[model samples]
Structures are given as structure tokens and as C-alpha cells.
Target: MDKQRDFVLRTIEERGVKFVRLWFTDVVGTLKSVAIAPAEVEGAFSEGIGFDGSAIEGLTRTYESDLLAHPDPTTFQILPWRGEIDPTARMFCDLTTPDGQPAVADPRNVLKRTLAKAADAGFTFYTHPEIEFYLLKSDKPGPHGLEPVDRAGYFDNVPGGTAHDFRRRSVRMLEDLGISVEYSHHEGGPGQNEIDLRYADGLTMADNIMTFRTVVKEVAIEEGVHATFMPKPLHGEPGSGMHTHMSLFEGDTNAFYEEGAQYQLSKTGRRFIAGLLRHANEIALVTNQFVNSYKRLWGGDEAPSYITWGHNNRSALVRVPLYKPGKSQSARIEHRGIDSAANPYLAYALMLAAGLKGIEEEYELPAEAEDNVWALSESERRALGYRRLPSSLFDAIRYMEESELVAETLGEQVFSYVLSNKRREYEQYRSQVTPFELKHSLDII
Candidate 1:
């Protein structure tokens, strides 16, 4: 800890950074910060910056609001996206209450608690996310209404596509912030792109995700464009998703990997996948929280509507990826349904809970569906014991509200808060009459 503190202090002095932002996130995963002079960093290191927890979403209520933003010195990074004249730096924070207990409702705290459970079970959770998003001309309504900035298709490298430049800049910025990018490419939809981050522990990956969104938007704004993580942003095209690859570790050994096992996945790995599929419906509200999120899920193509696992089937929600020869460490399950807009901490917590439950119960994994599940008739799917995910935000909430696993996983405070918030959103969505209804059926009905 002293080493990091000294490193940050010395870096500030040497780099001539004018402001050091103490960054944290609200419960919904929106990044928040309070800037301090370099001289105040020493004090911040010893005692955290004080803030009103009541002001932050899903934080404390007004009565008991005092909170602390204790900076994690390990997260310190100079802002490469910012200007050089008055260079800025930042670090992620851990929240605590006045009495120094970890804030119960903090999203990061939620993940930590889950991780602690995994630690007790002698497993470490690791995650790598392939996050997709769109770069729009602007979010504001235009004469022809909202539109995509380009008409490019999958992997089309336009000579000077703003998307290409934006992605290059975004990836570089992420590297500068200590996050490694494995790959970046244009996606199926115009202006849509995917950036895959290298695998890391769950907590670090969650922090990286928060930083990733900010860096993407910051670069988009600088390039006179806007980035949206909205699932199904364009009705006719593929939507953004955060297809997460996950595995368990015991020290340096990969728990999911086994030599000569089917797809190189161990028995424990299969159980974990079973757990995810078993509890998938109950946790859908967390994975696909937004109203439009369901739209993407049900939409044809890569979006997974059914709870099934496959070796290589893109339509299945959970895919056991093919193992690369001699790459035992890379064996992991890819969860397909989670969207980019979710609070990563909460999403990850629920995922770990579900998977760990599978391990504990020794749940039997279902047969892999090699053929496309999407092509099967509804009746056929039913006969095969395949179940569809929640069809709407309301449906997801209905399932989540009754989940003891979710309640236990998120604890009392967050489980209730998320359910209440999601219900409110679903209610509002149900009450609204959209342009689709008006344009298609207004006169006909």
C-alpha cells in the first residue's frame, strides 16, 4: 500500500498532473468523481474523501448518509484521454460508512461479498467481457429522427471510417488506463463495434468495464460522435451485448480446464454451466435490466432467447467455447445474454452465485444443442425441454421478484432496490404508447 501511495505521489510530481480525481461509481454503475490537488492526496490516502451517500443512487437514505470514498491506490492511472497542459489523473475507490464498515448497498461491495463467498469455497472468479456499442452521429433528434453514423457492415474497414479511428483511439486510451484490449472490430450493425478486454479477476474486470464506457464516450465526443450502449438501439439491426467469458481459478490453476475432457471442460465446469442455465430466468432482470434489453434478447440472430448451452451454437445462451490446443487456461464458459448496460458488479455477483450454487449442488448439465436452437419450432423446443428467457422487462421482474437465490445473492438492500426500480421502469414502459403503435395501428385499430 505504501509503495502505491509513493508511486502515485511521485508520478504526480514527475508528470506535472494538476488534478487527481478520486473516482467511484453509484450503485447503478455511473462513474462519479471528486477532484483534489496533489497535496491533498496524502491525506486522501490515509483518510478517504467524505461524501453524502444519500445523494448517490441506491446508496444510503437521508438519515444515515455520511460515506467515505477510500481510493484504491492500485487503481491509480494518469488520464491519457485528457489534455497535456493541465494533465489529469484518477483512481477507483472503495466506499465505506462512517463507522468504517463496507457500505452494504455499494455495487462494488456486493461483488466483494460474492467473491468472499467464492474465496471461502476455494475458488477465484475471473471474467473477460466482449462489450459492443454503437457510435451514432448524435443522440439528439434530427430532421429524419435518430440515425446511425455509418452504413458499414460487419468487419468492413472503411478507409477513413470515424468508427475505425474512434476504436483505435478508444483502445489506446483503455491501455493507457491499465486495461488490456484483446481485440476491436466493426460489428454486424453499422457504427456498431466490439472491444474485447483481456481476462482478469471479476472485481478488476468490473472496474475496467466502468472505465471502458467512460473512455469510449470521451473519445466519441472528441471525434464529434456519440456512443450508446443501448441494447437494440436500431430496430432492424443487431444490438449491443456484453458476452462475458468466465471461469474459476485456484491460485494459478484453471479449475474449469481438464486434459482430454469434452471441450477440455472439467466436471466442475459443467456443473457451473448447469447452475447458470437453471437460475438464468430468475437473474434475467439483472442481466438485461432495461426495457429495450428484452427487445434485443427476442430479436432473431445472435441474441439468445432460450436457456441452453452448446459447444459452438451462437443461438444458445451459454456456449462452451472450443479449447485452443495447448491453451488450458483459456477454457471457459461464455454467457451470451448479458447486455452492456448492466451494473457489472451486480451482474457478476448474481452470475457467481448461480454458478457456485451449481457447483455446490453438483447439478447435471443438459445435452448440448449443436444445431441452431433458433431454427427449431416452439413446439419442438418445448418437446426438447428447452425454456425461453423472459420476454419483456415486466416478465423478467416477475421472475426476479420471486427468486430466493437473487435475494440471497444481492442481499436485502440491493435486491429490494433493484426490484423496485425495475418494476417502476416496467410500469412506465407498459403505460406508454410508442411511435411503433401509433404509426402502424393508430388508424387501422
Candidate 2:
């Protein structure tokens, strides 16, 4: 008997769970679900639940539309929002073929596969994300677009404000679901909030991120406010970002730490940073996927525009925080370019791949930018050998299209589908007439 499977069954019976929701993500990181009666939970663990994949984004070809969702019992958690009456539990599912093989195009599987490669290399990856997002008054748009729940600025405290209440309720819900949050506070932008999740193994952190987005939105609905992970939701306002801190370990020893090195970063860590800088452009599609994502990257403020590493420099694409005394295990690098709206599974996979590539090839670490990269003039930055990340989604696509590393990491199924999907999206966006065009050129042209 499978202990975890049996534990899920016992919990369901003991907790009066009448519905079991099987959850997974599409290629673009949108959450998808199907609820089954309590009786079907056991069968779902063994035989798997069948679903049609014809319409799901980047899932598979429609000609062979059948797919199976095999629920991993380890992810089982009861829904807190769905009260005591017929309580619902959820488990994340892995997409599989009818023959019981892992589906190539499944974003979760893509992450799992990349993680396995790291395991083979005798390293374990860990990640912590400081997620930023905005809270709106409602989903409805006005002349000024969606209004914020509050106008609070960075770390501002507003007594009994909706943003405050929203964070409280959202944090409580996250805790109830077994996610540990390190901190929650007001961000720089109006009505923007940030919640930093404690570090966890890469796979677990990805799962936690998917759950976090859901809990925030659910609480927003209950509070009569709207929550968005959109990268650039408001014009002229700071955009939301999911800045991730990453590290690798060999058993219990942090591979990134050294006793007496510059920044206390070990040789392994330096190579890993080299890998990230070299491939940042190639993997930009997965990290900051949307066209609007570029607006945030180049929109100034805390958002990093150039590719460089530095100590405590938020203006650089990768920042190494000050090492805490007696906290050797905490030494890590923070990648700041990822927007809040990215698909966690694919994003994490490519990030791990990039870092590992650097280590494998013994890529030498570049010179650290001692001064602010964003403050430097164009010629000065070029003179220092710093490169800018993909300026737009178009440039990102061009870089990704020619990348062997990304193709191997994501597998052919996902690589082809993503390219196709993003191309269509870019074309569709270009075909539209934006308000900026009308305001600037409609009358003049």
C-alpha cells in the first residue's frame, strides 16, 4: 500500500472532504483544474483521471487529444476558502500519455526533467522568490484604468486599509495551506504589495508559487478588490516583479559559500553566475514572457536594464546581498529580471539549466559592476562590457529561436509550441491600435 495515497484517503474521510480538485498548469502558467467526487480520489492515484487536452495551451496536438492527469498525493491540501460544508481538497497532477509516459509539453514535467539533470550532476537547487503585485479597486476599467486599493508607497503602514487587510487574509490563507512566508509589506508602487516566500527546494518553491497566486486572487474576490500579477498593469507606475534568490548545494554544504573569498562566493557560485549572464538573453522568453514585461525592465526605477552582477546593487540584473554573519548557508545570488507574471515551472527550469551550463563548461565569471549599471551612459556601459537584456519580446524570441540550451532543456514539444504561441501573441498585439497611438498620432496622422 502507498503510504501517501492512504494518508490522503484517511484525511479525506476524517476531514469530511467531499470534493477532490486535481490541479495543473498550462504552458503559459495558467492554473487548470477538475474536481472529482471523494470516491474518485483513489482511482485518480492509481489509474489516473482522463482529460481532453485539445484546447489546453501547449499541451499536445489535437489529433491525439487524450491525456491523463495523475495526481501526486504528496501535494494534497484542503481548500481553506471553501468552508466546512463539503470541504474540498486539491492535489497537483502530472500530465501523462495514455501509455503512462510523462507528457513532453507539460510545464511541470519540463521542470521535473530539468531538475533530474541537476540531481545527476550531484547538486540540489534551492530558490526563494520575493513576489510583488498590485491590488486594484475592482476588475472594471475606468478612464484612468483600474484604480488601486490604496496609494501607499514602499513599506508604508496604513491602518485598516484594504491592502493591509488583503495581505493579512492572504498570508493567513497561505499559512493554512502549508506555505511559509518570510515577510509581507507594501511595495514602491501604489497599491502594490510584496510577499517574500522562505527558501525551499526548486520544485517545491515552484508549486508554492502556483498556489500563492490562487490564494491571493481568492482573497481579493472575497474582499471585493481585484488582484493582478500583470507585469505592467499601470502606465507610468512601477511594474511588479518576482525577484528570485537562488543557490545550489552539495548535500548539506552550500556550494555557493566559501570561508574567505570576495563576497564569500565560492568558485562554483562564480561559474554559475557566469552561466546566468551568458544565457540571460536566450532564456528571457521563459523568464519575462510577455511583451509588457519589457516595459517594466526598461521602465527605470528598481528594475534592472543591463546584464551585470554586483554586491547589494539592485540596479544590476543579478545582485548578491550582503552575507550575514554565521549564516553561510544563506549565501545566494538574486536574479531581478523575472516579472511577477511568468510561468514558474518553465521559468525555474530554464534558470537552473542556465546556471548549470556555466558550471559544466567552467565559464569564467565576468567583472562585477562596482557602480550602478543603470546610471552609466550607453558608451560607458558598453566600455565596461556590460550587455543589456532583450529590449523587447521580439528580441527575446529571436534569441530563443537560436538557442540549443533552451531547446534541449524544454524539449522539442514545448520549444516548438512556445515559439508558435508567442509569435501569434506578438502579431496579435501589433495588429491592435492602442490608446497611445490614438493619443499621439491619430489626429496628427
Candidate 3:
């Protein structure tokens, strides 16, 4: 730790970094930052910076608001978007109390606690997310309504076009910040795009997800366009989903792999899939936490709505990607239901906890649903023992309220706060009259 701190300080001086930003997230996944002068970086690493935590959502109560932001030196990176003049650097932080204990309400701490359990079981969780989002002409809907920067479809390469150039610039900036983006291309929806981040450990991946969002937005602004991760931003178009590929590792070996087993998936891998399938509904609120998120789920444009697992079945919640011969390390599963808008820390924690529980309990892996789940009738799906995910934020909250796994993983403070916050969001959404209602019901009713 001392060596890392020294390295960070030396780099700040050597790179002429004028400011170091301490970054953390609220329970709901909103990024919060505080800038400190380069001279204070050393002090921050040693003693941490203090702040009033009550101001941050789901952080603390008003009376017990004092908290500390301890920057993790390993996460240090210079802000490439800031350019050469008055350069800025940033690090992700973990919140702790005055006595130096991890804050129970901190989202990062929730993930850390979960990862520790996996480590105890001789495993490390790794994830790679295919994040999909849209670039709009403007932040707000214009006179002609919300307009995409381009009308290109999936994998469409409009050379020298807005989206192509935008992705080129974005990927370069991301690489400069040390984020390994494996692939980037236009997605199914017009003006929609997807970036596939290379796999990393759970904690690093969550931090990278947060940084990825910020970079996407910053690049969008620099190019005079707006980027949105809203799961279902447009009607009659495919929604943005963060289909996350996950695997477990035991030291250098991929714990999820087996040489000759079906799909080359090990027993540990099957149990992990069982855990995810069994608890996916309960964790849906955290993974897809907005009213808009349900729209993407039920809308059914490759966004999973049913809790089932199968090899190469995109409609199933847990999908085992087809294995490559002699490449056992690449064997993994993809959880298809999580939206890009989720709080990665909390979401990833719950996922790890649920998967670990399955392994601990030796949960039985069910029959694989190879057929298209979306095409099945409700009765047919029910006959096959397939269950639907929460249809709305209201339904998701109800499942979350009943989830022992979620409650234990998030701790009491965050569990209570998330429930309360989501309930309020549901209420606020229900009170509003939508354009659909007015368009259809005003004259008819």
C-alpha cells in the first residue's frame, strides 16, 4: 500500500497533474467527485479526506453524517479528457467511518464484503460487460422529438460519420485511461452503440464501469451530442442492456471450466448458474432498478425476461456461451437481464453472493431451456418451470423485500435505504399521466 501511494504521488508530480479527484458512488450508482490539489494527494492517501456523508444519497443519517473517503491508489489514472493544460487525475475511493471501519452504506464496501466471501471459498469473481447505450442529437427532446445522432443499424459502419468517429475517439480516450475495450460497434437501435470491456476482477470491473459511463458522457459532450444509458430510451427500438459475462477463477485456473463436461462447464459453474437463475428475480431491482428498465425486459428485443439457463440461448437469463475448443479459459456464462443503468457495485455483490450460495448449498441445476423463451405462451413457459422476472419496479421491489440474500449482501443500512428510495420512485412514477394514456383515452373515455 505504501509503495502504491508513493508511486501515485511521484506520478502526479512527474506528469504535472494539477488536481486529483477523489471519486465514489452513492448507493444508487451516481458518481460523486471531490477535487483536491496535487499536494494533498499524499495526505489523502495516508489519512483520508473527511466529508459530510448525509448529503450523499443512501450514505448516512443526518445526525451521524461524518465519513472518510480513502482513495485507493491502485485505481489512480490521469484524466485523458482533461488534456495537457492543467491536467487532472482521479482515483476511486472507499468510504470509512471516523474510527476507520468500512461504512456499511457504502456501495463499494458492499461489493468488497461479497468478494471477500468468494476469496474465502478459494475463488475470484471476474466479469466483462457488453454495455449498450445511445447517442442523441441533444440532451432534451427537441420539437421533432428525441433524435438519434445517426440512423445506422447494428454493425453499420458509416465511415467518417458521427457515430464511427465518436466511437474511435471514445475508444482512444478509454485506452489512454487504461481501460481495455475489446470491441465497439453500432447496435440494433438507431444511434445505439455497444462497447465490450475486457474481463477484469469484480472490484476493478465495477470501478471501470463507473469510469466507462463518465468517459462516454464526457466524449459525447465534447462532440456536442448526448449519450444516455437509459435502458429503454426510445419506443419501437431495441433497448440498451448490459449483458455481463462472468466467470470464477481459482488462482490461474478457470474454476468454471472442465475439459470434457457438457459445454465444458464445471460443477462449480453449473451451481453458479443455478444460483443466478434462482435469485435473479430477487436481484432484478438492483440490476435493473428503474421503471424504464422493466420496459426493456418485457419489450423482448433480446433482453431476457425469463429466469432460465441454456447454452447460446439469448432469451434465458443465464446463458452459457458456446465454448471454443482448446480454450477452456474463455468458458463462462452471461447474465442477460442486467441493464446498463444499474449500480454495478451493489448489483455485482448480490450476484456473487447468490452464486456462492448455490455452490455452498449444492443447489440443483435445472433443465436447460434451449428453445426461444420469448415465443412461448405463458402457460407453456409455466409448464416448463420457467418463471418471469419482475414486470415493473413495483414488482421488483416486492421481490427484493423478500430476498434474504439481497438483504444480507447489502447490509441493513443500504437494504432499508434502497427499499425506501425505490418505493418513492414507484409512487412518483405511478402518479404521472403518460402521453400514451392521453393519446388513447382522452377522447374515448
Candidate 4:
């Protein structure tokens, strides 16, 4: 830890970094940053920097607002988007109380707590998210109403197209920040693109996801295009889903792999999938928190709505990708329900916790749904014993409220805050009279 801290301080001075931002997240997963002068970086590492926790969303009560942000020197990276002259560096921080205990309300701490459970189980959880988003001509909806930058669909590489170049630049920026990009391609929707981050351990991956969004938005701004992670930004188009690939590692060996087994999935892997499927509805509020996220699930465009697992079935909530003949380490399950808009810290934590619970409990894997779940009728799906994910934010919240798993994974403070926050959001949405209502009701009623 000392060596890492010294390296960060030395790097900042050598690189002439004028600002070192201590980065953390609120309870809802929004990135919060406090910039410190380069001279303060050393002190920040040892003493920690103070911030008003009450001001941040779902962080603390007004009376008990004092919080400390201790920067994790291992997360130090130069902000490549900033000016090169002085340069700016950033580090993801661990939030704590004045007395130095981890803050219960902090999103990062929530994840860390969940991760500790996995560590106790002799496993390291890793995730690779295929993050999808849309590029728009402007930030606000214009006359055409949130126009996509290009009409090209799904891997269509037009010569000198904005998306092609945009992706290239975005990949470069992410690489500069030490995030590895495995793949980048245009997605099924107009102007929608997908970038798959190379897999990393859960904590590092959460931090990377946050940085990925910022880098994407920054690159979009530089290109005079708008970037959105809104799950269902455009109607009649594919929604942006963060289809996450995950696996458990017991040291260097992939714990999910079993040679000669069905789909080569180990018993541990099967239980993990069972845990995910069983508790998916409970975790929906965290993974797909927004009202619009439901649209993607029910949209029938590869985003999963059904609670079932299968091998390479996109419509199933969890799909085990086909394993290479000799490459057992690459065997991992892909969770297709999570939206790109989710707080990765909370989402990933819940996911890991749920999976760990399955392992601990020795959950039996359910029957695999080989048929496309979306193509089946509701009755057919129900008859096959498959359940649907929450249809709306309200439904998700209700599931979350009833979940012992969720309540345990997110401590009392965050669990209550998220439930209350979502309830308010749903209530506000329910009270609103939509444009669809006005357009139809004005003529009829």
C-alpha cells in the first residue's frame, strides 16, 4: 500500500498533474468527485479528505454528514480527457466515517462488503460487460425527436461514418485510462453501439464501468455527438443492455468449468446460475432501476425478460456461452437483463452476492430453456415454469422490498434508501399524464 501511494504521488509530480480528483459514488451510483491540488495527494492517501455526505444522494442524514474519502492509490490514472499541459489524475476512493469505519451508505462500500463474502468463500468474482449505448445528433430532442447520428445498423461500417470513428477514438481513450477493450461494433439499433470491456475482478470492473461511461460521453462531446446510456432511448429500436459475462475463480483455475460435463459447466457454475435466476427479480431494481429499463426487457429485441437459463439462448435471462474445445477458462455465463444505466457497483455486488448464496446453499440448477423464450406465448412460458422479470419499476421495487437476499446484500440504510427512492420515482411517474394519453384521450374523451 505504501509503495502504491508513493508511486501515485511520484507519478503526479513527474506528469505535472495539477489536479488529483478523489472519485467515489453516491448510493444511487452517480459518480462524485472532489478535486485536490497535487500537493494534497500525499495527505489524502494518509489522512483522507473530508466531504459532506448528506449533500450526496442517499449518503447520510444531515446531522451525521461528515464522511472521509480515502483514495485507493491502486486506482490512480491520468484523466486522458483533460488538458495535456498540466494534466489531471484521478483515483477511486473508499468512503469512511470520521472514526475511520467504512460508510454503510456508500455504494462502493456496499460492493466491497458483498465482495468480502465471495472472498470468504474462496472465490474471486470477475465480470465482463458488453455495454451498449446510443449516439445522438444533440443532447436534447430536436424536431425529429432524439435523432440517431447514423441509420446504419449492426456492424455496418460506413466509410468515414461518425460511429466508426467515434468508437475508434473512444476505445483509445479507454485504453489510455488502463481499461482494455475486447471488442467494439455497431449494435442492432440505429446509432447504437456495443463495447465489450475485457474481464476484470468485480471491484476493478465496477470502477472501470464508471470510467467507461465518462470516457464515452467525453469522446461523444469531442465529436459533437450526444451519447446516452438510457436503456430504451428510442421506441421501436433495440435498447442499450449491459449484457454482463461473469465467472468465479478459485485462484487461477476457473471454478465454473468442468471438463466433460454438460456445457462444461461445473456444479458451482450451475448453482451460481440458479442463484442469479432465482433472485434476478429482486435485483432488477438495482440492475435495471429506471422505468424505461422495463421497455427493453419487454421489447423482444434480444434483451431478456424471462427468468430462465440456457446455452446461448439470448432470450433467457442467463446464457452460458459456448465453450471453446480446449479453452475451459473462457467458460462463463452471460446475464442479459442488466441495463447500461445501472449503478455497476451496486448491481455487480448484488449479482455476486446472489451467486455466492447459491453456492453456499447448494442450489440446484433448473431446466434449460432451449427454445427462444420471447417467441413463446405467456401461457406457454408459464407452463414451462419460467417466470417473467418485473414488468415495471414498481414491480421491480415490490420484488426488491420482498427480497431477503437484496436486503442482506445491501445493508439496511441502502436497501431502505433505494426502495424509498424507487417508490418516489414510480409515484411521480404514475402521476404524470403522458403524451400518449393526451394524443389518444383528447379526441376520444
Give stretches of model 3 more than 4 Å off.
none
Error of 4 at 317 (Å): 0.3
- The C-alpha lDDT values of all candidates are 0.92, 0.93, 0.94, 0.93
lDDT of 3 by residue, 1-445 (tens): 9999889999998999999999999999999999999989888888899999999999999988999999999999999999999999999999999999999999999999999999999999999999999999997998878999999998998877789888989899889989999999999998999999999999999999999999999999999999999999998899999999999999999999999899999999999999998999889999999999999999968988889999998888999999989887898999999999999999999999999999999999999998999899999999999988999999999999999999999999999999999999999999999988999999998
Candidate 1 matches the true fold with a TM-score of 0.98
Q: Count the backbone clashes (under 3 Å) in each candidate.
A: 0, 0, 0, 0
Best model per lDDT = 3
RMSD, each candidate, Å?
1.2, 0.9, 0.8, 0.8
Candidate 1 ranges with C-alpha deviation above 4 Å: none
TM-score of each: 0.98, 0.99, 0.99, 0.99
lDDT of 1 by residue, 148-243 (tens): 889898888888879889989999899988899999999999889999999999999999999999999899999999899999888779989999
Residue pairs in candidate 1 whose N, alpha carbon or C atoms collide under 3 angstroms: none
Query: Which candidate, 1 or 2, has the higher lDDT?
Result: 2
**Model 1, residue 375: C-alpha shift (Å):** 0.3
Estimate the lDDT of model 4: 0.93
